[model samples]
Target: MTFPEKVDYVIVGAGIHGLSTAWHFAVKLKARGKCDGSKIVVIDKDSIAAGASGIACGVVRNNYYQPAMRELMTLCVDVWESDAKNLHYHNVGYMQISPKCMEEDVAEIFAQQ
Candidate 1:
């Protein structure tokens, strides 16, 4: 088989995790002016997002019951909101209903961190 002449990143699996990682790598490479000549090859036994991501309910929640978890979720929210402009992400709004326990847990986590 003919292979690419050069590659900057070789990603295996095209599920949500792999694709997301590749997206970030592309962003970083572009920001550093390395994307022009860089090659990012993602290989998977199946098509992109065809595994768990395809079957996933597409539900995003902050129910991890940890402050750090909530903080991380918040970071995800920020990125998702702004990703449309910077990364060409086209998606609807994010929605999450926090239970009282999760809220308390997140509060404590934030306080501790």
Candidate 2:
């Protein structure tokens, strides 16, 4: 594999989080006038965003039952919609589908987060 002469950061995973982190790092470097696609490289054992990000349904929502997760998920959604626009992102509008009953067990999901 060919590598860069110099690299600023190396993220292992090509999942959404890794890609987002790399994007933000590049954005910050650009904002500081330190970079414009310079010396920043993201390498995945596989293809970029070919893991979870590719298989995901790309749903954005804040209606989660947990507070912390809800906030993080909300931030993820915002970045996907707003920040992605600079790179030409089209928002298809996220939909949150709830179960027929609101009394289902959602505590585990929140707890894991």
Best by TM-score: 1
25 in model 2: Cα distance from truth in Å?
A: 0.4
Q: Which lDDT values do the candidates have, in the order given? A: 0.72, 0.70
Candidate 2 lDDT over 1-113, as tens digits, reads: 58878786777787878877888888998899998755667778889778878887655555567678777876776767677857555656444455757535454444544
Model 1, which residues run further than 4 Å from truth?
1-6, 80-113
List runs of model 2 lying over 4 Å from the truth. Answer: 76-113
Error of 2 at 1 (Å): 11
Q: Write the per-residue lDDT of candidate 1 for residues 1-113, one digit (tens) a residue.
A: 36687776899999988988888888888889888424888888878887888898754555565667778977876776775577655566444457886776656554664
Task: Note the residue pairs that clash in candidate 2.
Answer: none
Q: What is the lDDT of residue 39 in candidate 1?
A: 84
Clashes of 1: 0
